[model samples]
Target: MRFCSRWVVRDQWHEVCLYEDYFLYRTRAADSTAPPEEHRVENGDIADIGVDREGPLWGITLTVTSGESRTVPCPATIAAPLLLRWHDRD
Candidate 1:
């Protein structure tokens, strides 16, 4: 699956997409003029995948082995599939 998103306000809009073995997400807010940031982690670079949900809002938190964490807005429906595919790259 392939998906892309434009810049959105912080804590407002978030989008996460899977492109083959690559994980792409861009939801910028620090500077609206700036393009969304793209993050890619190879297999084994991931430490954990977390979900944050409140009312109707949902987000995905990715923690890498380096201890860095990034969050992207995600739909509740894709949350499970994304987690499974991310961890089970095989």
Candidate 2:
């Protein structure tokens, strides 16, 4: 599976991270060959997570802040009626 991600900074494109399985395949930024920022999530990191699923659509919350979050709707290529639960913080 391939996913496209765009990071915007100051109203401009900042960086992009491509994930293939559990590894990052490619990371690009506006002016540097390296990623704009490095994020290290712990082995069991779960913060501000939410889930949404309707009919044949499966959506997952990617980022959340102050109780507001963004959901990325997965295509039907992904299994439907899936359940996504937020892991409790340890």
Candidate 3:
């Protein structure tokens, strides 16, 4: 499955594309005059996942196999199905 949403990266909002195995993101505020900053993260290294709901926002925390973790926020409406996918995996 694939999903497109807004994600916070380096204190800025960017358009992110999430897939089952990885995610891709690009800064939305960059001007066309300059190349947009892009990044990707592979899910294979993710060892644990957690979810938190704060009003309408959903915070997803992913822990890497190496013990690093980061939380990213997205709307609950979009996160519900994604969380379900993770649940089904287990």
lDDT of each: 0.65, 0.36, 0.66
What is candidate 1's local distance difference test score?
0.65
Report the C-alpha lDDT of model 1 over 1-90, residue by residue, as the tens digit. Answer: 544433344454455766665566655665466766666776467788788975444678888899999776666666766777766655
Model 2 clash pairs?
Answer: none
TM-score (C-alpha) between model 3 and the true structure: 0.62
Which ten contiguous residues of candidate 2 have the minimum total lDDT?
81-90
lDDT tens per residue, model 3, 30-87: 2344555776678787676678988777777767788977776767776776666666
Candidate 2 per-residue C-alpha lDDT over 1-90 given as tens digits, one digit per residue, 9 for 90 to 100: 133444433333332232332212122345665544444222233244345667654454544233444454443333222221123212
Q: Is candidate 1 or 3 superior in TM-score? A: 3
Off by over 4 Å in 3: 7-12, 25-39
Question: Which of the two candidates, 2 or 3, achieves a greater lDDT against the reference?
Answer: 3
Pick the winner on lDDT between candidates 1 and 2: 1
